[model samples]
Target chain A: MIEVEGVERRYDGVAVLSEVTLSLPKGGLTAIIGPNGAGKSTLLSVMGRLQKPDAGRVTLEGMHLAQAPGRAVAKKLAMLRQDNHTAARLTVRDLVAFGRYPHCRGNPGPEDQAQIDRALAILGLEPLADRFLDQLSGGQRQRAHIAMVLAQDTGCILLDEPLNNLDISHAVRIITLVREAAQALGKTVVVVLHDINMAAAHCDRIVVMKGGRILRHGTPAELMQADFLSAVYETPISVHELAGRLVAVY
Target chain B: MSPEIRARQITHRMALLALLALLAAAAFLLLNARGSWDFLLPFRGRKLAALAVVAVAIALSTVVFQTVTQNRILTPAIMGFDALYVLIQTGLVFGLGAGRVSALDARLVFGLELGAMVVFALLLFRWMFGPAARNLHLLMLVGIVLGTLFRSIAGFLQRIIDPDSFTVLQDRLFASFNAVDPGLLTLSALIVAGLALILWRLVPELDVLALGREAAVGLGVPQERLVLGLLVIVTLLVALSTALVGPVTFLGLLVANLAYLLLPTGRHAVLLPAAALIALITLIGGQALLERVLHYDTALAVVVEFAGGLVFILLVIRGVAR
Candidate 1:
């Protein structure tokens, strides 16, 4: 489990995240749905240990992220930020192989290679494995980044805005990959998503935030009411049952 | 390409560069040694070694620096090494007059320059990288500001100095292989080799670091500490090379970019040496060509700077910095 308590982060004395307390269970896909500047990414970043909080502490799988050794924490959890840019021309396989750096330290054994191969296979990245990242389309590059995290093979994975430039098909493929990783591999996956329908349709739980505070955290069925979402977004939203799943429209 | 094939290709390219560097070194030695074999051999050999050291230092520093900053256009040159030298030289001449400054022992002048550069690099970078870890663009801006400030101060000093003294000072300013201080050269080799020892361990981390700060940190590379270490190493190497020889300005830029273009990969293990070899080839080969065929009296720095400046502008025009 990942637990965050009283986490507060400020930029230039302005609170970007405030008094945020949340927990992610051991397994399953948890989508963080929120408006822009809702502090959802900030909360996730703190939980993943990407950005340190001004107050409070975060622990992953009972180990405090701040105090844990970097290698140890890396073995347990993986975090991917929104903007991953590089001028280095790296092949897909080369990029994915870096996931094992914490474990192998650049000298990969048979098992590390196996993990890399599995990551590539899981993401359907085999065909494009030899291609350079810059040569690939944005959706492909997004998947390649996702493949790298999956190759880390950690217990908990945090991804912010993984669907930024992905098309519907690739996005669905990625969600399915995340869901499968959570269900089959028993990994705790926390994804910050902007789309409510995708979160409702796929995630086991959705955490809603507004103005740097967590407003709601529940299963899709529990938070599927129109009034609840409308209140959270400060706009009129309607919820309807589509294909036995709650879909939100505004 | 797959890792194995790409790895093989990189090896082949490195071997090619190494062979070319060797050939150039041999040609430079043999062609330059026409009369008084004993006297010329050691003399030319020392000069050759000095050139090789400067080339390697500049090339590796440039590549490592570009990777850290994630900006291809930025180099250690931009960090004010040459400008700092000019400012110091001009200041010394302005205050003490040309005769007094020129009368100072060559060893004393070299020591002063080296000490000033080391202090300058340490002070400037210690504050530049903040706890929050400022972005690459901000760092570039700071370097440019410092360089411009140094240039302006040097300009002010040069304007007031007499013409005869100014000409003498200009000779000291331009990079000339004929005038390398043996004492400084030995000191530089030791310092650069020490930096290289530390960098050997950092090669793997640097490969990952080239992916940028967020990924490096996320993957457990300890971005802050690694970047600080790299900055220090780059600073020392740049200072050492600049003190040993007058600044080669774009030589590092030219060699590093060529290495990248020749071998397109993220592996620094291959990239560093490849860049070093390219630097060697450019320096030794160009030096030999100018000395033998063209019988050029101009400093090698002139040709290097001209070529490097052109490459810099091409990179900018191509928008490769992004």
Candidate 2:
């Protein structure tokens, strides 16, 4: 379980997140839904230990996030940000192999190779593994990066806007993959998403944020109401049930 | 490519580097052996040793600096290291008379230059801007400002010094491989070797570091401390080489980029040696051509700078600045 207590983050006297407390239970998909400037990415970064909170504590399975050794924490949690610009001429396989660095420290053994192959297979990247990142299309590159994080084999995965730059087909595939990983592997997945309908359809729990604070948190059925989303987003949203799944139309 | 195929390619490149380094060393030794066996051997041997030391210092420093900055076009000299050395020389000549400055201990001068360069680098790194400002443009901008300041100060001091003393300082400022000081060379070799050992121990970390700061940190590398250590190493290497042979700014840029083009892998193990070999070939070959073809009448730095400058322009035009 990941627990955040009174987490506060401010930048140059402007509060990005204020007194945000939340708990993410293990073995499920939790979608953090919010409008722009809602501190979704900031909260994800704080929970992943990428950024420190000004006034709060984060604990991951009984260990303080800040105090734990970086390698130790990396072994248990993996994060993929929105933008990954690199200067090195690395192929898809090369980038994914780096995911095992926390375990093998660049000297990958047979076991590491096996895990890498499994990740490539899962992401449908075996054929494109030899292609350089710059040569791939945006959706392919996004899937490649996701494969890298999945190769890390961490129990808790945090992804900030994983659906960006992906086409509809790739986006649906990725959402299904994340859901499958959470259900089959018993992993806790936290993702920040802009598409409210996708979040409602795939996420077990949705947390709504506005103006740097969590305004509401509940199951999809409760949070997907038209009135709740319209108030949260400041736009008219119609909720409809299509084949037992909630769809939000704005 | 398959892993086996890539490994084979790396091994092949390593073999080629070893062969080139050996050939360069052999040619250097043969060219320096001209007079009586006893007298000429030791005398020219010292000069050869000095050349080898400078080559290694410049090559290693350039490769490491590029890695840390994640830039192919940047070198230690870009940070005004050579300008600082020239400024120090001018200050010495301007403060004391020529006789006193000449009489000062060579080792003492080397130590002072090394210390000043390291301190300057630490200060610059400590004041680094935010992540968005960490691009090559910012580095180049700050470097140009500092370099202009150093050059202007040195020029102003040079104008005030006596003509004879100014001549002495001027001779010291231009890069020439033929007139190396043996004492300074020995000290520099020791410093270079020590730093080389430290870098070898940190090779694994450096491989990760080449991926840039955020990715390195995400992979569990202590980014701040490692970058600081690398800056210090780069400072020592740059200071030692600049003190020995003035400054050859574009030489590092040429060799490092050439290594990148020739070597297919991103692994530092291959990239470092490939760069070192290119430097060795350029220095030894250029020195031979100057001695034999040009009758040892001109500075080797001029030819190297000419070739390196061309390569620099070509690389920029080719849009490989990344």
Candidate 3:
């Protein structure tokens, strides 16, 4: 479980995240949905320990993220930010193998290699394992990044804007992989998503944010009402049940 | 390429570089030699050692710096190291005049330059990366600004100083291998060896750092501490090399890029040595060619800067086109 209490982050005297508190459940797919500048990514960044909060504390599984050893925290939590880039040219296999650095410290044993192979197999990246990241398409590179995250073998995974720039087919494929990781592997997965229908159909819970504050947090069934979403977005949005699933339209 | 094939190919390339470096060293020592064996061996050997030290220092520093900054077109020199060296030499001439500056002990002058540079680099970087970890782009901007400021000040000093003193300063600043201070060469070699040892231990972390700050931090590599340590190492190595020979601006840019292009992988273990060997070959072989074959009177730094500057332009254009 991740506990965030009174977390506030400011930039140049302006608060990007204001007195926000949230508790992320241990094992499920949780999607943070908000419009641009709504602090969705910032909240996720704080929870993942990518950015420190100015006012409060965050703990992952009873261990303070700010005080714990980086290696220990890494073994428990894995965070992947959007638009990953590297100066070094790395192959898919090489990139995934780096996920084991915290454990193996560059000398991967047989077990570490097995984890790498499993990640590649899970993401269907074995075919492209030898290809460099720059040689791959946008979707393929995103998959490669996810594969690396999976190779980390952390209990909790946080991804920021994983679906950005991906096509519908690719996006669905990635969401399915994320869902499967949560379900089959029992990992706590938090994803920041732009597509509401995809989140409604796939995620177990949804957290809505507006103006850097949490507007609502509940199961998709409880939070997918038209009035609440319309108010959260400050625009008219309609929700309809389509074949047993709630779909939102604007 | 498959891992096995790629590993073999890399090994083969490394072997070729080593062989070429050896050939260059031999040719540098043996070409057009007619003095007594005793005098020839020690004199040529000292020069060879000095060149090799500078080559290693510059190449290693450049590659490590580029990896930290995640930039292909940048070198440590862009942080105004070379400009600072010029400023130091010009300042000495301006303040003390040419004759007195020349009469001062060469080792004392070298010590002064090296100390001032290292101190300046630390202060500037501390201010940038101190209270909070400032972003690298801001750090780069400050470095460029300070570099331009140093250049302008040096230019002002040069304009006012007498022509004879100005000529003396120019000779001191131009990067001539023919005038390496022998007393300081041994000291530089020792310092470089120590710095290389520290860098070698951080190779694995550096490989992770190439993934950029977020990924590095996520993977349990303490990004702030590691980057700060690497920057200090870079400052020391750049200071050592620049004090030994005046600034050889483009050699690091040329050799590091060549290492990346030649080697098919990104592992720093392989890349660092490849860059060093290439630098060694460039300096030694280019010196031999100019001295023996063409009978050229120009410093080897001139030829290197010409080639390196072209490579820099090509790299920039290619990046933009891409």
Best by DockQ: 3
Give the alpha carbon lDDT tens digit for every residue of A54-127 in model 1.
99999887899977777788888888788887789899999999999889877789999999999899878999
If both were scored by TM-score, which would come out higher, candidate 1 or candidate 3? 3
lDDT of 1: 0.85
Q: State the DockQ of every prediction.
A: 0.68, 0.60, 0.75
Q: Which lDDT values do the candidates have, in the order given?
A: 0.85, 0.83, 0.89
Off by over 4 Å in 2: B1-3, B129-140, B179-183, B309-322
| Residue A18 alpha-carbon offset, candidate 1, angstroms | 0.7
When summed lDDT is taken over every stretch of 10 residues in candidate 2 chain A, the lowest stretch is A81-90
TM-score of every model versus the real structure: 0.94, 0.93, 0.95
Tens digits of per-residue lDDT for model 2, B1-322: 7767877887887788778777866666676456687886676577667777787788889989989988877888888888898898889888987889889987787678778877887777666644435455777778779989999999998988889998888887887766767777877889988998898777767777887776676677777778878888888888888878778777787888878876766777778768877887777767766765677778888767776667657866776655
Query: Candidates sorted by lDDT, descending order?
Result: 3, 1, 2
Candidate with better TM-score, 1 vs 2: 1
Task: Kindly report which residue stretches of model 1 are placed more than 4 angstroms away from their true locations once superposed.
Answer: B1-4, B131-133, B305-322
The alpha-carbon root-mean-square deviation between model 3 and the true structure, to one decimal in Å, is 2.3
Across A129-239, the per-residue lDDT of candidate 2 in tens digits comes to 988888898888888889889888999999999999998888998999999999998999999999998999898999999888999888999998999889988999999
Candidate 1, A224: how far from true, in Å? 1.4
